[model samples]
Target: MNKDVRASVKVGGQGQWSDHEKWLIEQGQQRIKTLMPEVYKTICRYAEKDSNVWRIVRLGLVGRPDQFWACEAGHVAGAPFTQFKRAVEVSRLIARFGCAHVCMIAGHGDLGGT
Candidate 1:
C-alpha cells in the first residue's frame, strides 16, 4: 500500500462525493493508473476492493484527514512535507511510479512549509 492510501484509510465517513469531487477523484485515479502503473498497482495491493480508497487519498490531499481535523485534540503529522513538499513528493511518487499527474492538489503554503 502507498502512504496516501494508508493515510486515507485512517479517515472515516462513507465518502459521499459531490459530482465535482467524484470527477476529480476519478480523473486523478485514471491519470495515476495510466501514468504511474506501479503506484496503481501498489494501491491495488493495499486497498480493499470494496472501499473507495482512492477517494480517501484525494480527500486527504484536498481536505484534511477527518479524524485528525475532527477532534480539537488531534493534530496533523508534523512531517517536513505535510503540505506542498508532500504534494511534490506525491507528484514525484506518481511520476516515479509512472503516473502522469499527481493525485494530490497542493497550495503554495503547502509547498513552502518545512
Candidate 2:
C-alpha cells in the first residue's frame, strides 16, 4: 500500500502575485502548450476529470519553480488529485549517476568533468 507523507516547512510569507509573476505563469503555460502539447492536454484532462478547477500555486522563492498546476477537489473520500511542476535548468552538476550526461545534454557547460 502507498502512504502519503506530509511535512511542514516555514513559508516565510505570502502575498498576491505581481505582474511579472502573472506574466511568467502565462508564458510558462503557453510554452508548455506549444512544446509539450501532450503533457498540457493531460493536465487539462486531469483537471477536468478530478475537478473542473485548475489552480496555480505560488511559491515564496525566486529562482525556483514559478508555478504549480493542481486540480482542486474538495474533501471527499478517494478524491482524485494531481500536481505538475515546472522544470528549470540545472545550474550545478554533482557527482552522481548520469549527472555529467544530463549536464551535457542540458548545455550547462562542463562541471569539471563531473
Candidate 3:
C-alpha cells in the first residue's frame, strides 16, 4: 500500500497509473454496483452505457457520485463534484478505504492523498 502511494504519486512519480490504482478503480465499481444500484442505474442513464463518462467512472474518476450527493443533500446550488467531494458518504469511504479507493470512481485521484 505504501509502495503504491510512494512510487506512483505525481510528485515522486511512476509516470504511469499504478496497479493498485487500477484495483481501487475496480473496487469502486463493485461498490457502486452493490451499494448504490440506483446511482449505478442513473449513471447508465445519464452517462449512458459504455460511454466515455461511464468508462471514466469505471476507472474510479469520481463521476456520478457527485450527482448522488447532490440529490441526497438537496444542495443543488454548487457544482456536483463539490457536493461529492465534501459529502459525508465520501468522507467515510475515504477514511475506510483510502482516497485512491474513491478518487475517480465517477472523477482524478487528486495526487492521491488520504
Best by TM-score: 1
The TM-score obtained by model 3 is 0.39
Error of 3 at 70 (Å): 8.2
Q: Model 1 compared with the native: what TM-score?
A: 0.40
lDDT of 1 by residue, 1-114 (tens): 232332342236554556564554555555555556554554454355524544444664344432001101121211123433354665466447653322222221133223
Task: Candidate 1: list runs displaced more than 4 Å.
Answer: 1-11, 48-52, 61-114
Candidate 3: RMSD over Cα atoms? 12.1
Computed on alpha carbons, the lDDT of every model, listed in order, comes to 0.39, 0.29, 0.39
Give the lDDT of residue 92 in candidate 1.
Answer: 67
The segments of candidate 3 whose C-alpha lies over 4 angstroms from its true place after superposition are 1-16, 59-80, 83-114
Backbone clashes in model 3: 12
Q: What are the C-alpha RMSDs, in order, of all predicted structures?
A: 12.3, 15.6, 12.1
* Model 2 local distance difference test score: 0.29
Cα lDDT for residue 99, candidate 3: 36
Clash count for each candidate, listed in order shown: 7, 0, 12
Model 2 error, position 107 (Å):
32
TM-score of each: 0.40, 0.36, 0.39
